[model samples]
Target: MKNNWADAMRKNVHHLAGSLGNLLVESFHYLALFAIGGITAWAAVMAFLGMMEKGNITVDDILLLFIYLELGAMVGIYFKTNHMPVRFLIYVAITALTRLLISDVSHHGPADLGVVYLSGAILLLAFAILVVRYASSRFPSAKVPDPDATVKGALTEEKGET
Candidate 1:
């Protein structure tokens, strides 16, 4: 009986520790999400102000805005669905590279331009691969349905509804 009691206590402690760890991890995840959202907002506001001061939004400015938009979308989607699509990041990288190429065109010669173009092409290929991976079920995904949907479906089944 004493040994059984000790084992029960140990199991309870282990369960409590696991619960606490999960809580801590969830708290940190939300904190990081809020930080990302705040920084994205700050960047968007700064970009808008810069464009206002310049009196004209240049292509670089537009591309920067696109980057900000993609970042914001990434954050929002993660917050809602808890899934981060790799394609969004690839799109952001492509946009950033294109912006860099456009802004540095006057500073770079033919060879440098070729290198930049090649880099952009590589990014495009990565984006294509991600698209195909998502399009085909043969590739594994980290995405899962919302927990709320699972709960609702269970409740509906309990009620004898489809």
Candidate 2:
């Protein structure tokens, strides 16, 4: 009974914490929207200046914009789903890693390049799996229930069903 009381108290504390955290986060999101606007304007100005100076846009520099785009997309998805899918995070990480590798590969050789390529391949496979899993869950197909697996008796099978 004492342990049960402790568990109940712990749950109450967590519930209070979650409630307070949600309020604070929502307030911050509203306040931060103004900052986001200013930052986006500054980024656009910088991009325009860089384009004028170079006479052409470098894809390397555009990767920075891509990063910001991913951030905005992530926030957008969060607002839409109240939960962002892990695939977007994986895609963001993959792009960031690729950007880093591309920026630094001037001093790298075949072996180092191979390692980077392998890492990218692994991340790609993981991202693909995540996408497939998400698709399957979102569009579930007809599936038969397992034999002798009732709502409660999932482990213990019926005596004659074996």
Candidate 3:
């Protein structure tokens, strides 16, 4: 009985600590999001104005599009899910690699070219795994309850119902 009581107390303390920590962390996240959103909005407006004034569309303009889009996506996802996932790291990595490749491919040698190509391949594989994992997790074996319908058939039935 004493050990059980101790364990219960420990659990309660652990839960309390976790709750407080999460509250502190989320508060910081909200502040950071507000600051970043303000700065990004200001910068995006300035960049659009600059592009229009120049009359020449540089790759920098396109880069700005991607940066703002990804930033917005990251912020939106956090608000929706209340937390970020490891899968987003793959997306960010791929985007960063693509940006680097686009900005510097002309200045690279054969070895550098191979490295960039390999980086792209690895990113592709990571994205494929992420897709498969997300798909399987979201839509598990639908035929588990009724074996007569194959998984694919069950998925088709699900789609039809939806």
Candidate 4:
């Protein structure tokens, strides 16, 4: 009897510890998300302000803003669904590479082969995005049921619907 009691106590303690650890990790996860979202917003605003001050919005500046927009969208989606969309990262990479390629060409007159490499990289990333999309659609994972749908289902059952 003593050994059984001791085993129960140990199991309870282990479960409690696991719960507390999960809580701690979840809290930190949320905090980090908020921080990243806020920082992205701030940087985007600063970039816009800088462009306004210069009174000129170049393609590079626009591309940078697009990058920031993608990042903010990514954070928002992750916050809502707890799932990060890989395509957004790919979009950002494509935008960044395009921006770099433009800057390099404009400054260096396309004399070097960097432009070719950057264009190739952008093409590869674009292909990767397509592949990812195709694979996701082809082998879709189980999806979480919508909470609103669950409530609606309960209401329908209460009304004697089959």
Clashes of each: 0, 0, 0, 0
- Give a tens-digit lDDT track for model 1, residues 1-162: 999999989988986887789789889999999999999999899989989998997888998999999999999999987778667877787788777777676456545756667576757768686776767667676667765578689889989999
C-alpha lDDT of all candidate models, in order: 0.82, 0.68, 0.70, 0.92
Could you tell me the lDDT of residue 135 within candidate 1?
79
Model 3 residue 124 CA deviation in Å:
5.1
lDDT tens readout by residue for model 3, 7-80: 98998898688778978987998888778777767777888888899999767467666766677677768777
TM-score of 3: 0.52
All candidates in order of TM-score, best leading: 4, 1, 3, 2
In order of appearance, the predictions have TM-scores of 0.74, 0.49, 0.52, 0.82
lDDT of model 1 at residue 108? 68
Clashing pairs in 3: none
Q: Which residue pairs in candidate 2 have backbone atoms (N, alpha carbon, C) closer than 3 angstroms, thus clashing?
A: none
> What's the lDDT for candidate 3?
0.70
Looking at model 1, which ten-residue stretch has the lowest summed lDDT? 106-115
Q: Which ranking of candidates, highest lDDT first?
A: 4, 1, 3, 2
Residue 53: error of model 4 in Å?
A: 1.0
Residue pairs clashing in model 4 are: none
